[model samples]
Structure formats: C-alpha cells, structure tokens
Target: MIPLYLLHITTVEHSESLLWTFLTCNVFVVTAGIVFMYKLFTQKKVRGAGIVFGIAIAINYILIAIFGDPFDLLG
Candidate 1:
C-alpha cells in the first residue's frame, strides 16, 4: 500500500493514466490475497501470520471503498 501511494505520488504528472494503474494494482493485490487465503483454508491450517496479514489488507481495502480516502476527505 505504501508502494502504491508512492507510485501514485510519483505519477501525479500522468493523472489520466494513474486511474487505471491504481485500479489494476488494487485488483491484483486483492485477488492474490484471496487466493492465498483460500489455499490456506483448504489445507486446514488457517492460522498464523499469513491469515492476519490478508485480513488486515482486506479490511483496509473495504474501508477505503466504503468511506472514500481519508486523506481526500481532509481537503
């Protein structure tokens, strides 16, 4: 997420293309996380750091979608 923000900042000059870039990144991360979680679940080992990390990422993405960017609201 930090890296995505950094890329967003660096690509400010290309705002038109940034939309697609950001969307693609979001899709990729969420999809990968889901796949990882599913694999872990099926193996009967759904405990530990990987699950926690995936849940955290999923929650963050959900909140962002629900509330809009907190940073954006400040302005």
Candidate 2:
C-alpha cells in the first residue's frame, strides 16, 4: 500500500487506480486481522498476535480518517 501510494505521488494519471488499490489492500488486511483474532479468541489460545493486529488496524483506520481519503482527490 505504501509503495502504491508512493507511485501515485509520482504519476499524474491513474490516481484512481492507485487509490482503489490502496483502499482494497487496507480492507483486506483489516478483514484478515479480524478473522485471525476471532479464531484465536475462540480457540482459547494466547492473543498476543491478535492484539497487535487489532491495534495496527485501529491505527490504520485512525490515520485514514485524519488524513482524509485518497478517493477525495478524484474530485
């Protein structure tokens, strides 16, 4: 996602493509993290990985909200 964002910064066209790619990557990561956390919690196993992933996902969401959506640049 960072690499795509950097590439978008260098190119004037195809910004939408890059934005979609970035957003999709983020959504995939968050979804996977949630699923993993759920499985860990259900299995009664140590949740250290789950907690870390959860925190990372939360931070990602907060940063996106604060920084503004890349799609907004389409207008």
Best by lDDT: 2
lDDT score at residue 3, model 2, on the 0-100 scale: 68
On a 0 to 1 TM-score scale, where does candidate 1 land against the true structure?
A: 0.41
The Cα error of candidate 1 at residue 75, in Å, is: 15
Compared with the true structure, the alpha-carbon lDDT of candidate 1 equals 0.54
Across 19-71, the per-residue lDDT of candidate 2 in tens digits comes to 67546646666676777768776885546667767776665555454455556
Task: Provide the overall lDDT of each model, using Cα atoms, as 2-decimal numbers.
Answer: 0.54, 0.58
Model 2 TM-score (2 dp):
0.41
Q: How accurate is candidate 2 locally (lDDT)?
A: 0.58
- The reply for model 1, stretches above 4 Å from the true place, is 1-14, 44-75
